[model samples]
Every structure is written in C-alpha cells, then in structure tokens.
Target: MTSHWPQPPTFRAPIQPRQAGARNGRFELALSRHGARTHIGRQYVSYPFHMTRPFAFDVAIPSLLTVYQQSSSGGLYRDDRLDSRIDVGAGAAGHITTQAATVVHDCHGQPAHQTTEIVLEEGAFLALTPDPLVLFPGAACSSVIQARLAPGTVLLLSDAFALHDPEGRGRPFERLEAKVDIRDAGGRLLVRDNLEIGGAHLSSAGSPIGDWKVVSNFMLVGAPDRLPTADELAVLGRPERQVVGITLLPNGAGWGVRCLAADAIAARVIAEKLFVLAVSAAFGQQPAPRRK
Candidate 1:
C-alpha cells in the first residue's frame, strides 16, 4: 500500500528560454514554490559578447510564493538548500544578470522578509541588476542580501525600489527595510549598506529621499585596478533632477553609487550612464545594449 502524502510540485517539462516581448525590454519570471523548495522555475539565458570572453550563468528568483498569494499575513522564508546560493560563470567567460519584481496583491499590512546569497568563483563576472521593486500601499517588507566574491572576480550589483498606490489613493507603504552585505572569499567584510523608511519619514521635507519616489544603490566590487579613476567617477556620478553620489569601497576593492530620483525614468537614466562608465573603466569597452 502506498502512503498518501502531498508530493512536491515538479516541472512538467524541461526548462526553456523565454523571449520577452518586444515592448518589455527586460525578461521577468514569477516566483513560486515546488514542494518545500522554492524555485524560479527553469528560466535561463546565455549571451556571447566581447566582455571578458564569452560566459553563461543562471538567474534564480529569490522571493517566496506567499508574496503572490492573497493572504492577510504574508510569509517569507529562505530555502537554504536552494534559495541561499546563486552560481555564476561556469564555463568560458560569462556574465549572469538576475531581475526581480515584487508585486503585493492583498498583503493587508502583513510584513514579509526575504534573504538571498550569491557566490562568484575566481574570474567570474556577475551583474545583478533587478528592476525597481514596486511596493503597494500597506506593504511592510524587509530584504537582506549577502554576496561573497573570489579575489579575481568582478561584480556589479544594483538594488532599487519605488512606492506605489494603484487606486490613485495617496496612502503610502507602511515601511521598508533593506540591507546588503559584501564579503571576500575569506568572509572578510568589504561593505555593508542599510535603508529603513516609514511612511512618516517619506513625507518629511528633509527626508534623505526628498521629493524622489524611487531610490537606487549600485555597487561594484573587484580589484583596485578594475575601478574607474576618481575624476571619471565624479563626472559620472552627477545627474540632473536627481541626487547622486559615488564613493570607493574600503581597502580599494571597488566603488558604489547611490541615487534618488522622482521617477523610474530618472533613476534609469542615472543608472545607464553609471553602468556604461563602469563597464568602460573596468572592461575597456561599452556593455551590450540592455533592454529598457
């Protein structure tokens, strides 16, 4: 006799590359759970370009399924066996980019937590530039990220978010907390960044975000020689209609850029310039055109 227990969900077919429509500049995948394990479903892409030879890597979605369900108390947990690790640059020269979007359907003021970990082997290059997270009104979320890079590895990571009120109501999100930690292969901490904001603070005139509806932080970690000169970085850090700043990472490892903008377009404009400048400075060539 076979005992009856709920079996984990399995992919019905082999994973395949998805072609994002011509209008959508970026590829996107919804988050879901397979049994007790959470998977981004099998979605991957490979591109050969002039940057550091040709390489390939998989993009994993890191959010939990509860986020999509209509529940009063949303829950979020990391599947250590799976969600905790992302591997990049397995063969030849490669680059991996991961994009994530957060959609809150009926959170009802429930709070959620998410954590992600990334590891890059020596000589591997990774760019984790997810689209801006859109937090609906009544959302209270916290996100944590940990990344470990080998000595010779290069990394470009970006995290950005925007608040939204779909019903045309003026209500703001409840709160948001974000933290990012970067370390070397030996577990030595290189940089730590944190952001916490509440609805009240967001309305304050002197708030750090000021009139900006979106905020973004971009960090590049690699050897000193891979970073741009101070003057070049300074010039790239300036953006009209937005507040932006750039600073070198500790111990000459790399640099970071922080920007605040009134809208998503403004933020992307600043990011595009910074990304191009960084790629040119580190790789000696412009990056392949990234879809909007």
Candidate 2:
C-alpha cells in the first residue's frame, strides 16, 4: 500500500515598480530560495542620475533628486534578503535621499525573517534615511541590518517604525524583532542595537515605548573625534514635547541619537537637526538643503 501526501507550495518573491510620476527612481528585483539560502536573482534599478546593471553589491550614485522605492508585493516573507550598496558623493558633492517604506504583511500567526546589508564607502556623504516601517495588525516580522563604512564617510542613518490598523479594528501586531550593527573598515564593531515589541508588551503600561506612537533612531558615523561632544550633542538633541537622547559609540567611532515623538513629522524634525549637526561636524561645512 502507498500513502499520498500534499507537498508544500513553493514561494516566489515578486518585485513591483511604482509609477514614474512619483519620482525618477524605481527598483525591480526577484528573490529565489534554495533550501535554507535566499538569492537575489534578477534586478533592474533606475535613477535620474545614472543607470547600470544591478549587482549583489555596488555603489548607488543619485543626483539632486529624491529616490522613491516601494514593494509591489506589499510585504516580505520568510528568509528574504535585501542587500544594497550606496556611495553618496563618490568624489564630488552629491545630495540625494532614498525613502523606503517597508511594509510587512500578516503571516497567519507565523513570523517571517528578513536580512538587510548596506555598505557606504569613503568620500561619500549620504543621508540614508528611510521612512518608518508600518507594521499591520497581526503581522509578525524579524529584521536585521548590517552597515559597513570607511573612516572618511559621512552618513546620517535612521531607522524608525509605527504600528497601524487600517481596518479600524483594535488588533495589535504579533511581534517585531530588529537589530542593527555597524562596523568599521577593519571589521571592528562600532555600535549594536536590538529591539523587540509584541502584542502583550503593547498593552503593558511599563513598556519601554510607553505611549509613544512613533520612534526614530539616528546614527552619525564618520570621523569620530570630529563629531560633536557628549555635552554638545545633548544640547543639540533637546526639543520640546519629545523624548530625545544622544550618545557616543564605542572607540570614538560615531554618535547615536534616539527620539520618540507622538507623530512622524515631529520625529523627522528632530532627526533633521541631528543630521545637520552631524554633517557640519564631519565635513566642516553645512550640507545642501535636503529639499523633498
């Protein structure tokens, strides 16, 4: 006698490009799974400044335009990889912003894992900041980011998120686990951050997030000693009606700032100030106004 059983369905990651009316930027990519490993198979990226074949790792040069990116599939899945490489100035004065709105869909009580890696080389001055990640109700996600930078690199890196319930129902998200690690050229760790939030903790009064609907973290990595001092950074981060704090990274590698606000705009304002200060300190000059 022989028994019959249904096999699991194979999953294919889809890439969607938004309309060009929004901005002159878009990315189309596909992901395939081989056993436990995920590979970035095909990709097509367009920017106003230049066009080139998408490689697993390469520098991203953007002109004086805002690069807008979105996922057509709406969300990520289990064991997905999102790797990117960006070079801001490249050798001349370059000013560009890439805004990524990463949305994770509900997984039917199962959690999905995604890995992201970014590299910013020397002589690059970039504001690699993404809009807050919006987690839908009942969605569970785990994300990790690794950034490698050179000594002369000036960067304003930000990570933030907010919860959402579009259906008007009060259901909370399942869980969000995230971590960020920054390393120097010699593979030495400069900063490490970890965050975890679940449904139960959301209802707890003692939750670390406490009533703050929007949380943003900004880190300035470059010439460590040239950055602002602890006392100066503290003064620069202070703002009304918001909780903000700044600290120095280990071994004088850089500085990190954490801000919590009642809304996204407020958080962005705080981040902007920090970005300006960091850029001025790193390059000894004010950066071109980030018009978006």
Candidate 3:
C-alpha cells in the first residue's frame, strides 16, 4: 500500500517477520516543542497508515500541532490488527485525530483489534480525540488504550462508538469492547475503564442504552489542582439530546466523564465542551473553537 504522509524526519522499519494476508501494522511518533511551535521529532508509519501534515489552527494555543491520521484500507476485516504509539516531550502540545469515523465491517467469528500507546513527559499537553468507530451488523471489535504520563502532563482524551446497519435492517452489531488504562511515569496503574456492549442487548426490551445511539468516555488527565470540581462538571450537559455525568477519577489521575447521546453530533458537542473546560484550566484562557 502507498503512504500519503510527507517524508518523515526520521524513519526506520524493524525486521519483524509477517504472515501472508496479515494486515497488522503500527506507527510511532515523538513530538517536541521548538521555540513556540511543536514539531514531530521522529516517526515510523507502516502499511495501511497515512497522515496529513501537522496544522496549527487553534489561535488560542498557537503551539498546538494537529495531525489527522488515516488508514489506506477502507475498513477493518476479520483478523485485522493495528497498533499506534505517540510520545509528547516536555512542554510540547499536540492533538491527534482521524479524518472520519472508522468503519468495522462484519468479521463473523474473527474480530478486528486495535491498540494505542501514548507517553507524555512532564509539562506536556496532548488531546487525543478521534471520530467514533462505527460497527456494522455482525461486526465485532476490540480497542484498548494505554497511557503513561508524568506528573505535570495534561491530556484531554476521548473514546466513542456507534452502531450501523447498511442493509436497511434493524440488526445490531455483534459486539464492541473498549478499555482505557492510565498509569504514572513510573508505570503504576492509576485507574482503568472498561466497556462492552452486545448488539442483542440493544434489541432487548429495557435496553441499558434506552434510545441513545452513541456512547462516549472523556478524560482530563493532569495534576489534581488543575481539575474541575464535581459541581463544575455536573453543569456540563443540557437536557436535550444527551445525558452526561462527570466525577473525579477515584485514583486521582484526573476527571472522567461518561456521556450517552442520541447521535454523533450530541456526543461531539459534549466532547468539545470538555475540551474547552480543560484548555481553560491548563492554558489560563478560553480556546478558539477548533474548526473541523
């Protein structure tokens, strides 16, 4: 497969053996601040992965670099595996996102898997927000995130998923499983979040999701003094189109929010609100709206 990314500053490939027809791939990047701008110091992206040049569009955080990741493949299939890693150096700022939602097609009995690892140095701030994964009928997928952050590091991260049926039928996806684990610089696990939903559950009477079509989890990880209070977070959502609740992470990594929305737009609105709040807390000013 061809890659769309600009030539990397530093690139290399390992000598790992591969199996025929295997779609396994991985990409790693390290970002650091130079003067007032953040730039990628190193990168290694393999097949099925492509990304656009970094853009600094947020006037409020001019140093913030934004990268849009893409996959050459149309969507995930049976036995597909993808892994990616990101490192933010001290004092660096960056945001990583996808151009569109990733579609997970029917995998029958073999599910697709994706894992991401992120590292943040002291004083670094990064936003990891990607479009939700859309699961088609009979699709099954598993996703996981592992983050190791220094004490002063800050992160505004989000995870979300939605279901779809392309044949005009009301069938739900087989299942979707997701997990997020946060750890300190010393590799001590602070907290973990797990989610699993089966399509059959949604079709049953008294479904836990009710009428909601999207599920989202947002986290603001940083020093305790920089997090919002429970009362402040309780006022984050409205009575229309969604439901949300926020509370301090019991292990004190930061704050965690659980949001359920009728659609992607509603979920996105809540995510943005959390971004704004987190930015104001970390940057000491209101951030300019990020234009998608």
User: What lDDT score belongs to each candidate, Candidate 1 first?
Assistant: 0.55, 0.57, 0.79
Model 3: runs farther than 4 Å from truth? 1-20
- In Å, residue 110's CA in model 3 sits off its true spot by 1.0
Model 3: colliding residue pairs? none
**Poorest stretch of ten by lDDT in candidate 2:** 1-10
Candidate with maximal TM-score: 3
Model 3 / residue 288 / CA error / Å: 3.0
Clash number by candidate, in order:
3, 0, 0
Error of 3 at 103 (Å): 1.0
Show the lowest summed lDDT stretch of 10 residues, model 3.
1-10
lDDT of 3: 0.79
TM match of model 2 to true structure = 0.68
Candidate 3 lDDT over residue span 197-285, tens digit each: 67777756666777888888888888866666676677776767889977677677788888889898888888888877877777776
lDDT of 1 by residue, 85-117 (tens): 355432112233322344533334444455667
lDDT tens per residue, model 2, 53-141 = 32221122222223334344455543334434443323222222434456665655555565555555555445556677777776777
Better of 1 and 2 by lDDT: 2
Candidate 1: what lDDT? 0.55
